[model samples]
Every structure is written in structure tokens, then in C-alpha cells.
Target: MSTETDVDGGDTGDSLTLALAQLHVDAGEVEANVERALAAVSRAADRGADLVALPELFNVGYFAFDLYARNAEPFGGETFTRLREAAADHGIAVLAGSIVEDLAATESVETPAADGFSNTAALFDADGERRLVYRKHHLFGYESAESELLVPGETLETATIGGMTVGVTTCYDLRFPELYRRLVDAGAELILVPSAWPYPRIEHWQTLSRARAIENQAYVATINGSGEFEEATLLGRSSVYDPWGVPLASSGDEATLITTEIDPRTVVDVRDEFPALRDRRR
Candidate 1:
């Protein structure tokens, strides 16, 4: 990984090599999933990737609702501890995808005790330090029972990785433009989406991801899972996009690693050339 001074020398613009781990997570298999994630991280670091992003609910299957209560862990618990070790071992920043977390519910909430899990994502630095925790704010309810099992997140977070300000959101959050707008206002130059978006909605997944990049004029990289669940199937078209909404790399419905080099300066250049963001009234 290159230093901040080596890229553009000052922090106005920088470059980073990002790896999208389009993995296939096993349902209810935590140990196996951790091994797969660790192997992917090692491969990404060997390829000179500075930051590695994984798919949503990577430690367990996304649609495995029957196992949520049994698999859920508290924040900063054992699951995150393993991820932190993996990040440090690879000497690369890691986006630990999304996990099911058990958070204490307020008395007024009245949600069921078994249904008090938070769909959360964790980030770790090269030294295995916890950097950020982002819980999914938008809960999808058409085909699944996410709302019944997971609580919505209240805050949006932005962090610095490899000298670039990066924002985070989960699967359904991609459909909400307001979230990306808020991240842009927070000075996010790149947005990372970890998702478990399934098949038959691949078009929506691809289109929304590109739209976020185009509207925000920032780098957008989405990592998705690849496998068949009990009643649904993941599409796993993990991709990376440039500031001009051009695709840098995309994966198929298979377990693979997608890598791309991004220049943060290009975002500034494109925004300057187009000036579309300045024309927004609302």
C-alpha cells in the first residue's frame, strides 16, 4: 500500500486499490465462513489491495432467519475479534461485511427479545483496530422477515481509509438516494456497499449502484454474496464503479475476488468538469 504523501501529496486527492470479495457464504456455518473470509483477505493483500470489502452477512447466510438468534453476537465480541485478527494479519483495512448483532432493547421499544438483533457491519484498520460500526438502516421486508429480526440503524458513518474518505451502507440502503447525499455532504469520496442482494433483482442492484456513483460523483464499490439460500438465491454481481459511473470491474454469480484501482482525484476532476452537483436545488 502506498502512503498518503506518495499518492498526490497533501490529501486533496489520493488513490487506493480496493478488493471486492464476492464470496459464497454457507448458511449457519460460522467457522467455515470465517476461513473463507480470511482466505479472501489474504488473496487481496497479496494482490496489493489496500482495502478489502466483503459481502453482507458473510459469517452466516443472509436468508437464514431461523438462525439469527442463535448466531447473533454483541458488538466488539468474538466475531469482530476474529475479523480484527484477519485484518491485522493481512496488513490491510477490512470491511467485515454485515453481521447479526444482539443489542439491548429499550423498555418502550416493545420488540420481542429474540427479535432484537441489529444488522451491523464493522471496519478494522491494518493494525486490527476497530474503526467504525454501521448497522443497516433500511430493512427489506417484501420477501424476507428482516424487520422482524433486525433493528434499523440510527447513524451514518464515514471513515478515512488509505487517505480517502469512505462511506458505508448495506444492501437495501442502495435504493435510497438520500443516504448517499448525506454521505457526500459528509465529504465521502468513495462509498462501499456490502450486500446480499438476491437474484431477479439484479437489474435494480446494478442500476442503483451506478446511480449512486453518478449522482454523488464518487467511487462506488458493491460486494455481494454468491450462493443459493433455502428459498432465495444471491446474484453476486459485485462491482466497482468510477466517478463518471463507468464500471471498473464486475464479478459473476461465483465465488471470486474483484479488484480495481481507483483515483480519488478523478472524482474531483469529473465533478469540476460536469458541475452537476452544484446545480442541485433540493
Candidate 2:
């Protein structure tokens, strides 16, 4: 187990490496997308990444709203099963990004509805076991049908991995700080935000990500897709931020892998030095 030092020169014991797969996704191309995703994971594992994260709705394009219902599948369906196998084979954990979940066939842990759909994220452990699932709570309604087609999630999910507590949240949820606060209160030292955010909002994406890390004093890894859809082109500035709001790694619009070392102890050190979280008032 090799290790790396943090920004402050602290020894990062049991440091975890991450590979953010910024892949170009074609709408309605599930088979090709899955193969790309699996290949990314394998490459990450070859580089000794402890975990790999994909962007939101990579299976079915985020802008391909018309194909949602058709592509929607139950949790642990073929896509998820293959990803789970990939995780097991690669000997790494995977954050299989947002899927167009069939709400009728799926039973959400927080918000259980009889019918409709959801933007969901699934986490698989290195052992190929399902660890956590998070449905998107904040749906984009400004210029989209997300709010109309999907019901918002009602629960916050966290998992213990690589000597840290990691929380899960989707794309639009990044804009809401209150949700992140809840995650912090739930003992989340790191948060994975799988996003499908398009162009014209690059500033918002970067700003909000740093804000979340700064305010919570935690690691915020925002993994975004690098593809363009018929309706929009995704801003592929996928980034990873440390507790001090430093951009550890970032990517441009091309589909590529961005790897970084994350020290679980850095979160504690930053909170001790800054102590903003402790000073928060009601």
C-alpha cells in the first residue's frame, strides 16, 4: 500500500486514490457506454485507484429526456450487474453514476413511490456488493423536465471506505448547501457529486464545488461527463477539491481520467485549524 503526503505535508496514512472517468456519452447508447465505463474502471484499477466515479446519467444521456422511460431499468439490472462485476474484477470500488431508474420497479430507501422515475446513483464495494444508493433530491426544473419526470429522493446516504465516511449526491444537488450540511452532520468526510451539468454554468459548477468543500471542510469530488447531447454540451470541468477549497485536480472538455490522492486525515486537520464547522450557529 503506497501513500502520499497532503498539501500541508502531513503523512497520508491509508491514502485513497480516485479516478474520475470523464467519458463522452452518446444518448441511448447503453452498450457502448457501459463498455467505456468498464474500461475506465480497469484503467483506474491498473493505476491502483481505490475507487472510480462516473458522471451522471451516463447510461442514458441527461439531455435525452425522451429516452428516459425506455432506458430506465431496475436497480441491479444488467448495467449495474456488469458494473458490479467490473468492480470485483478490478479490485476497486465504483460509484456507478446516475441512472434513469424505473421507479415502479425500484423501491427507494427514502422516497418510495408507486410509479414515476428517478435520477439515481449506486455505489459498489470492491467486493462487488451494493453498498449505497442515492436518488437525486434536487431536480432541475429551470429548463428541463426532470422535475416533471422524476420524484426527488428524501434520504441522505453515507458509506465507510478507505478509512473515511463518504456521502453521495447528484448533479443539481450541488447547488444546495443545506443538503451538504446535512451530510456533514451525518459524519461525511468526503462527498462524491456525479454531475451531468451542461455548458454556460461552468462558473456555478466550480464555485459551488469549492463552496461545499470550504463550508463543510471536506473533500468534494465533482465528476462530470465530457460528452455533448443534442440539446446541450456538458461542461467537462470535472474537479476534486480539498477541505481548504484547493482544486487538487481538474479536467477540460475532453473525455479522460483525472486521478488524485485523497488523505482522510486532512479533513480532520483542516477542521482543527479552521474550525468553521464548529462555529456554525443556528
Candidate 3:
């Protein structure tokens, strides 16, 4: 009775069904936000999503700068535990990241700051296994306190799932092409970006995401939140771009799920046909 079906109904054994859980995050409301995210996960699984990505700081909405310290969690904290369990129960991979991680309070992992908090993302496979942890390498300093409050991460790593190598990067990191290049070099075929991009910068979001996909020859998915903060409102234009920079699936300014199918071989095919990555001198 499982609703899961292979992407495109082809036994390609390569295509992956991805879902973007674009939730309307309410600032300072941890329980309410987590409940919504859990509901979205169930919905995505019912729609046959093999992987569902939650937005950055979905637990404690990104713009809630004053509440960050109050909600900072450890490596295997409650919010992550619930999502991990949901991943296992529903048989879907979950990218539960960009939480305010209490680095000094975590266990069984090496923290970058040792005594501070960080914007961290964790990838959990369908089996509820921790695949990789990506800390937001770039902290936004544009009239924001993110850079002043949290510690930047130094780890750059990738994990494997659905016959493809997956890499992770958070918001603000999108502005740096070099990071994408590094991920490409590390054999990443699918890169997940969890963001809280605000309004008026829609053009920057679209252009940067597509450019990363085009240049890296990899599938790039940007999962953004939807909600208004005291000083800003999220853009909520979550999208998935193929290796050729074409948007396979997208959404507008709303709390919704954007799902799409991407074949790993498409990456192989595109990179083979274009041969642009081969021309890189840097």
C-alpha cells in the first residue's frame, strides 16, 4: 500500500524524488513550527518524495535573532530527534539543518567554536542515520546579527544517497561560487541549500541558484522559508534546478511543498555533453 513510485515511472534506478518543505516559520514559536514541519514531512512522503528538505532555521525562525540563544540545540537534540524519527517512520530522507546549534553543549561531535553557537544542518537518510553535518560557512552581516552571534563552520563534506553524492550548504553561502566548485570537486552531484532568503532580493536568489547548477553541472535545490519577521519577509521561492540550469520544479510566495524528480545520470549526461567543468583552470 506504499504510495512511493519511481520517478517518471521508469525503473531507471537513478532518479530521485525530492521535496522542498517550504514551511511558514513563526519567529520564537518552536513547538508550532516543528509541528508544521512534521506535518509537511508526512505530506511529502505520501506524495512519494524520497527526500524532503526543511528550510534554514525552521525550528526557530531565522530572523528571530533575540531568540537564537534561547533555542540553540545540541547535535542530537529534540528537534532533530523528532525529524530523524519521522524520516525513519515515513521511509524518506530528511535534511534537518540550519538550526541554532548549541555547539558547546553538543555530544559525540567536534564543534568548531567549542564555546559558542552555530548555524548547522544535518542530513539524515531514510534509515534515520546521520549522513553529514554542514555548518553555515558564510554568516550574513548585512544589517544582521548572525555574524556577531554565531560561529562560522569550517567543515566541507558530502554524503551519499540514492546513487548520488550529496553536498550541503546553507544561506549566504550561495554568494560564494568557490564553495560550489569545491563541492563539485568532492564528487557532489546534488547540492541542497536551505535558506531564509528575504524579499527584494528575488533576482539574486534565482540567478545565483541557477548559476551554481550550470557551473557545477549538478542539481541544485534551494529550500526557502515563508513568513514575515519584524523587519523582513521571506521570499519563499523554493526551486530545484537541473544540471543544465533549467528549473525542474518551483514555487511562489507561499507555505508549500515543491517536489521534483532528478536523475543522477542526467548529471553524467550533461557534464559529458557540455564538458565545461573540464575547461576550468582554477
Q: Estimated TM-score per prediction?
A: 0.90, 0.93, 0.94
lDDT of 3 by residue, 101-204 (tens): 99888977545646799999989999999898998999999978999999889989999988789999998999999999999999999999999999999999
Ranking by TM-score: 3, 2, 1
Put down candidate 2 lDDT per residue, 24-59, tens digits, no spaces: 888899888888889888988987888999999998
Ranking by lDDT: 3, 2, 1
**Candidate 1 lDDT, 18-86, residue by residue in tens:** 888888788998888878888888988998888999889998789999998898877766777787998
Model 2 spans with C-alpha error above 4 angstroms:
1-14, 107-111
Cα error, candidate 2, residue 20 (Å):
0.5
lDDT leader: 3
Candidate 1 local distance difference test against the native: 0.84
Overlapping backbone residue pairs in candidate 1 total 0
Where does the lowest 10-residue lDDT sum fall in candidate 1?
Answer: 1-10
TM-score of 3: 0.94
lDDT pick, better of 2 and 3: 3
